[model samples]
Target: MSIERVEIAASPCPNDVFILSGLILNKVLTSFEYSFKFADIETLNELALKKAFPVIKVSFALYPEVYPDYQILSCGSALGFGVGPLLVSRKEIKELNFADFKVGIPGRYTTAYFLFKFFYPKEIQKIFLPYYEIIPALLRGDIDLGVLIHEGRFVYAKYGLFLVQDLGTYWEEKVNAPLPLGGFLVKRDFPEDKKNRILQDLRRSLKYAWAKKDEVYPLLKKYAQEPSQEVIFNHIQTYVNSYTLKLEGEALKGIKVFFETLNFKEDPENFIWENKDGIS
Candidate 1:
């Protein structure tokens, strides 16, 4: 029998690398051969728009627009309390006047961008940059404020940046749900059995990482933008949780509310893949 090949794309953040390391390292057993691509979340989002990969990670904000082509896997989601993007600035301003200042956004389609726009909808000047560049741009005074995500949340203060808001906390307090950030999406046309296999392999991969943190730390550090072990540890602990293992309960609820907030009319449930073995 010929082994099938699968191409998957996700970010290089610690949480993502930590979760997928098992599969990437061939520690998790699966029926199909897998190849991985690492890219910034925004780049992955754009690639998804172009249908460039069979499986990819994307911001939840972009899911609705791509619903016709992909179905979200229950596992490998980055959503939880206290894990939203951070709004940071070089200096603390008493009053936020959106029209007067320019802000750096990671990408137009990122959940960070969506939350920023949803809360501060105004005629604000916005510049889109890669997540890594947002902090440096702010420090250089190229932008007045920046919405920081991934490991940026952990290290922005070290750069002397002031926290304008924890968008995750804000979303939790106002919407009363954990903020949905990103998730793995499989092509809707992929075989159902293959999707289930992928989900199972992913769950095993996550569990494997958790069980062998010392073993996986090197892998996490390998791809992480922030090299500090402390920041990488915190990043994985913050984003990968029960939600990463399976999207259910509050995680599922949070996703629903997020789509509703975007005025997505389709039932969110319809877009989530239901594993045939009833595991997810």
Candidate 2:
């Protein structure tokens, strides 16, 4: 059968660590029975979730767990980068005093939000909004603190937002591995054979990119909205790491600990390479 185009949606975060790899996956897998398309999910997790699943068919995810109707292909790598969510306060709200502030989250039910809750249950009073709005809302004083993701992770400091905590770093300290930032996932109905082929290609792409950082940087520059090649390259380098697809040992342990804290109650301490059998 002539392969149909496979669509992929990736988060807009510079630290995404998976999008370019997916793009490269497309490049490497061209000889296989597949063509590819990729999209950015802006900064809204819920919006991404709503538009992504079933329709996207296969999408990149930073947070673990899909709608239970989804199947995880493989975690690209243990992105050694985890800058824990910052609790950037507006104006004079110097330190995080949970009772006094309403933190803004990407979404109420997101894993990142739950991470906030699990670590700082006292901050349960925090507000949730579409990921994009949190920063502006914080600037407007509508929200006291913003729990940002994506590019916000890098540039929040420029917005005069103080990093109260680097959650990813915190996670690493707590669990001793790269925080489970994100990876590729597909709907249950995706053909198992195709999914496995795509999964292998994703890993291959990272290997290919790592060998040619100079080449990968151009790809990053191509997609990056930033004008300065130097700036964009630096940003991409800061988050992308050697652990992009190999989420085993410490990385898996880190993710397990993360879920445990959220009461997710399971320790998938190793990246299960195969998407479970009979996954429909």
Q: Give the best candidate by lDDT.
A: 1
Give a tens-digit lDDT track for model 2, residues 23-83. Answer: 5444564425433344443333444456454323222233344544455455453245554
Residue by residue across 1-280, what tens digits does model 1's lDDT show? 8889999999999988888888988998877888999999999999999989998999999998899999999889999999999998889978877677999999999999998987788888999999999999999999999999999999998999999988888889999998999999999998889888888888888898999998998888888888999999989889999888888899888999999998886876679886878753
Q: Where's the lowest-lDDT run of ten residues in candidate 2?
A: 54-63
Report lDDT per candidate: 0.90, 0.55
Clashes of 1: 0
Write down the TM-score for model 1: 0.97
Clash tally for model 2: 13
Clashing pairs in 1: none
Q: After superposition, how far is residue 199 of candidate 1 from its true place, in Å?
A: 0.9
